[model samples]
Target: MRALALASLLFFSAPPPAAAVAPPRDAYPDVARAYWVELDGKPLWAGQPDKRLPMASLAKLMTALLIAENADLAAKVTISRGAQQETGSRLGLRSGDTARAGDLLTATLVRSANDACRALADWRGGDQPRFVAMMNARAAKLGLRNTHFADACGHDAPTQYSSVRDLALLARAAMKQRAIVDAARLPSFRFRSGAGREYRMNNTNALIGRYEGARGLKTGYTPGAGRCLIALADREGHEVLAVLLHAPERWWDSIGLLELAFDEAKRRSRR
Candidate 1:
């Protein structure tokens, strides 16, 4: 009887296996190169959350945050020759064209306009490299060890990379800015430049209008980065944030992951 009791004690005293940070690899095969989800600020699931991957235009989140922090939204910004010359998604800004800083930010966050982002960066940092330096510095301060920036507009560069986990933190910070949050949620935005050019920019995030409880966030793609997205949603006071890097079907995957997060939150509440 004493020997039997000793065996029972030994069995019970052994540590349990580690909890999984994510489901099995097969559970979400090819969903993304890396992904992370959080429900109301608590980690829900993660897959390769720290793997360094190209973030694409998601880097503009940092640019928006810095502009919201330092620049006066009401101030006017003149379009520079360099800003107009920027490649990729743009608003067709021309040299000497002027717009309010806040309007530029709206275009950046909602439309992912590279020209608008570059203009804001130049207005605030006096140059793109200086703005990128500020971005890296802010990343360090935010305790994001796996994030780095090589450009203000999130161009695909050899040295530029971030993880889904770090981007979740960055999104949290970006959401703290009311303007950023407001712009991110809009389905479309209309504004006029100081030169009297009326522009209408539709939100690049398709989930904004179609997904239930889907709020505005950001989306990005490049030949190298594939497709990346930071999706946010709120339903019945529960908010879920999901980050997907290099997802081919980002829209479908984001919706499914967001639903999973909400379901996980519900289960936790019942417990």
Candidate 2:
């Protein structure tokens, strides 16, 4: 009886053979190479969040933020030669062309217009360098430690870089602006140059229309950045934000991320 009791005690005290702990779920596929966080006011998931890469045109999201915060929307800004001639996805504004800051913002958010970004940045900080400084300052204030800015339009600047987490923070901040949110969801828009030529721009974020509860967000691409997207969606009374960086196929990756986020959100809600 004594030997049997000692054996039972040892069996119970040996940590029960150490029950296995399940591996954490991988929120993103390996091909997409992403970081995702689902928060019902708290972080529920994270993966490779600190990996920094070029944001491409997603940097314009911060550009729009600074413009909305510092410049008057209704205020008219004259395009400078630098702004008017900026390459890559332009709204075709002329050097002498003029438009309201509000309209330029719409172009920037909805179209990712490089020229519009330049014009807005120039208007806000009087030049690109000064505007970049302001962007870095704002990012610091927002606690985006892994982000840095070299240009407003996110053209190929050697120093321009941001992480998925930082982009998500920028997206959240940009969403607060009604104008930006509205512009981001727009399917299409038309803008006229000073010479009366109309230029039409479309929303680059494909997820906005096809995904349920999807709202305005941003898309970016460059050789160095690959494809990137920041997406926001609300499902079943829960709001989810997803960020993907260096994705080969941005739209598909965004959809997959959103689906996972919504699934997790729904499960948590039920619990």
Candidate 3:
């Protein structure tokens, strides 16, 4: 009886699990509305993972998904006036820049280029609105109730939103596509035009080059959405997927959560 009581006390007094990264979540209080970590096939940790919120450029993963499904990267898409004039980050495509679909995809996924995404959408769906409808349809097919796309580039909109759960599903799905996995994981890519003009795109996700084992998915930010990130990493045979929504210190939070999750996965393997 005495030994059992002593063991119980020690167990109760033990420190928190090594996997709970304790992100100074309060320091960046309003940064993320939700975060989630998953390993192998099971959830490791979560905070408000199902809460819906604006998911800025993270929405482009869906756009990349649709593009990968319906078109070949070598296919050429002519930039329309509408595509040329999209707001936010741009690849500086002219009104008539005839770029290969693959080049545009590189710009969209690596640099979060709004103009490139619009061009891809127009090529894929005949118009931006039609492409957005396709995005919603695909979301429904994937059983994502909290995700919707008003635009292919993840621009701020009253109706556009997603939860970390849905985004994680989207990330894993996107990574399975060869093109997205290639582009999202790169640090930079140079796009050369038919006219010999060159544009270099820098990755928007800070964690890609900075974090060990970080592969990628996407990054997003808007005043309404805060900071959103879907980061992926693979070690040995284990895969870790992490999502942070509306977080200001998203890079640190993501690194902390991922390292913690990786440690947990290692411990689980021993068990």
Rank candidates by lDDT, best first: 1, 3, 2
lDDT of 3 by residue, 1-271 (tens): 2334433432333324434554312222232578777877466666776788899999999999999877888987888888889988887888876888998998898899999999999989999899999999999988898898898888889999999889988877787789889888999999777666788988998878887777887888777888788888887788888888887667766766666667767776787
Candidate 2: residue 232 lDDT (0-100): 80
Backbone clashes (count) for model 3? 5
Model 1: lDDT of residue 13: 36
* Candidate structures ordered by TM-score, highest first: 1, 3, 2
Per-residue lDDT over 1-271 for candidate 1, one digit per residue giving the tens place of the 0 to 100 score: 2334433432333222112433422234356889887778877667898899999999999999999988899999999887999999999998899999999999999999999999999889999989899999999999899999999888999999999999999999998999999999999998999889998999999999889898868999888899999999998789999899998778867777776666666666776
The clash count of every prediction, one per candidate, is 0, 0, 5
Q: What stretches of model 2 exceed 4 Å from their correct place?
A: 1-26, 29-31, 193-195
Better of 1 and 2 by TM-score: 1
Name every residue pair that clashes in candidate 3: 31-246, 31-247, 31-248, 32-246, 32-247
Backbone clash tally for model 2?
Answer: 0
* Runs off by more than 4 Å, candidate 3: 1-31
**Which scores greater on lDDT, model 2 or model 3?**
3
> Each prediction's TM-score against the native?
0.90, 0.86, 0.88
Task: Indicate the TM-score of model 2.
Answer: 0.86
For every candidate structure, what is the RMSD over all alpha carbons to the true structure, in angstroms? 9.7, 11.0, 7.5
Task: Name the weakest run of 10 consecutive residues (lDDT summed) in model 2.
Answer: 15-24
lDDT of 3 at 192: 79
